[model samples]
Target: MRIIRAAKVLTGRQGEVIVDGEVLVDGSEIVSVGPRGSAGEAAEVVELPGHTVLPGLVDAHVHLGFDAKVDPVTRRSPESERHLLLRMAENARKLVSAGVTTARDLGARGFLDLALRDAIEEGLAVGPHIVAATRPITLTGGHCWYMGGEADDERAIRRVARENLRAGADCLKVMASGGMMTPGAAPSWVAQYTTEQLRAVVEEAEVRGKGVAAHAHAHAAIRSAVEAGVTTIEHCTFFTPSGHRFDAELADVVATSGTYVCPTVHGVMWRAREVYGPEMLDDWLRGIASMREAGLRLIAGTDSGFGAAGVDNPTDGFVASLEVFAQAGYGNAEIIELATVLAADACGVGEVTGTLAAGKWADLIAVAGDPLERLADLRNLALVLVSGRSVTQAGVDTVTASVG
Candidate 1:
């Protein structure tokens, strides 16, 4: 048993902050969390007098296979599978060091994300708990066609979905619309799949007890995905032929259906000011604010591998994504919830992790200052505990012990 004592503890529950709190851990599960000195005897106690402890962050959307470079796609045309796996392992570790204890790999090639996930679980590699969507479903020669998942019709979509699920995919990912990464493919405003096709994928995953994540950018694609009942919508940008637009009726429908939206609001979004003018960037921010007004369930997802500024070191980008929510008029506590509890819920891991509660995995982090006041404090990670093991720590001993 061990006690992680901190000056403050944000249990990842909105508005629940315990001052002078202690979290008791027995093996990989949290035993209790309460005011300081309430947690009883333990084999060892790690104390942080000026720190704030919170649940480890969850990045709901990421692409572990793509190297976060200027052109992550074109450069990877000739790499072997072995080399890609090695690179993915390194990226996973980078995510861990940035305090992401749980991350969902939204897309990958050759089911390599599954292989990397299994390797991490077996202790052969170091990384956070991974929820992988192996080989995203796409239209023939559509976006991300190089990843080998391309289907022209519903039957082919079901076949590809079955293949990924059989290979131990935690969820299904469908490219409902085109995206920016692929060149000469359908543009972002183009809807690639029909409502019936997306519904087919959703129904297939539902029978298997898994949810489908739809990569929808076009307004039509977003509406179809909502009507088809996808678990989450990635990059829910209402793209048009000329520029972006926000449809309130569609937003209300999405909000009513209880579909979570991962806006992928990271540092790279600011680059829109250079390409599309400052007014467009301002409109983008306004759209995010409107989603909140419409009661849309928004979760934090950095889309880290897709040219996030400082993607190599993702801590800044992760926090910057949250900062965008702040710009959208969210409070610090609410933004924190988006990255922790809310993110975990959207990814279907709420029961096992997310909050710092008893019977949950002890996935938490301690920072030098209070993130509640200064969100940037998250970058100053003093210790990170993933399932009760100290993966990385500063100013603390190499804590190791057996259950007693």
Candidate 2:
């Protein structure tokens, strides 16, 4: 039994906050959470007098196989599977150390993500609880075709989807449009798959009690994904030949469908602004704000390990995403939810974790100060607990303890 007493506890339950609270944890599950003494005595008590404890963060979209510093396509094209898996294990450690308790590997090659997930579970490796999408379904020459998940027809799509599910994939990731990273492939605004094809993938996942995550960067692709009932839309950017085009009507349609959008803005503000230019970046932000106003649910995903500007620092990239939301006019509470409960729900694991509630996993973090008051406090992580096990700054195991 263990108790963590802190100056504030953001329950990750619809912006609820507990002042001077304590969380009782038994084994891997949280037993109770309330005012300081409400949890009573425990075998161990971790006191953080000037800190705040909140749900450990979630990153909805990540590609563990890709190295952020190198060109993903070039880096992985000839790399051995063993080498890629080892690099992925290292990436996972960095992610967990940065306070990301749950991460959904949106895309990966050869089901390496699944192996990494199993490794973490078996104590062979250290990483966040991973929701693996073994390999993303794409067109023969579509985006990320190198991942070896290309299906040219409906039959092939169904076959690949079933194969992935059979291989223990928790979800299915489908390429609905082209991407910026894959050169000579379809452009980002081009629709790679038809509505029927997208629907086929979604149907396969739904019947198997899984969800489909569509990689859509064009307006038409976004519409198709919404119509096909995808759980979340990755990089929901309305790209065009010239630049981006935000469609208000389509945004409203997406909002009505209750589909979550993962803009993957992590590293964008820092690295992409120069690459994408300020004008295009401004347009993207405006579209995001408009979508928020239209009731579209947005979740935080840094696109970590996907290579390029925004991903130089995978650990800090997750927190950088929250800053993007803040700049977009999101309140601190709302931003926190985007990274915690909302993100967990988007990744299909909200029931087990995401909040500081009884019966939930003890996946929370203690920071140097109240993040609710100043978002940057999140960067100053004092301790991170994933399922009641503590992982510190150095990625070393430790018992939960106070931070001065």
Q: Which has the greatest TM-score?
A: 2
Question: How many Å off is the CA of 325 in candidate 2?
Answer: 0.9
**lDDT to native, each model:** 0.86, 0.87
Stretches of candidate 2 off by over 4 Å are 75-77, 308-315, 394-404
CA lDDT, candidate 1, residue 52: 96
* Highest lDDT against the true fold, candidate: 2
List of clashing residue pairs for candidate 2: 267-310
lDDT of model 2 at position 181:
83
For residues 327-347, write the lDDT of model 2, one tens digit per residue.
888899998988999989998
TM-score of each: 0.94, 0.95
RMSD after Cα superposition, model 2: 3.4
Q: Write the per-residue lDDT of candidate 1 for residues 1-404, one digit (tens) a residue.
A: 99999999999978999999999999889999999989988999999999999999999998887766656766645689998897788778778877889998999998999999998877677678999998899987899988888998999999999999999999999999998778878998999999999999999899988888999989999999999999999989888886669999999999999999998887555664666567767877888899999999999988877674323424226776787788889889999999999999988889998899999999999999999999889988898888887776431122111101
lDDT of 1 at 90: 74
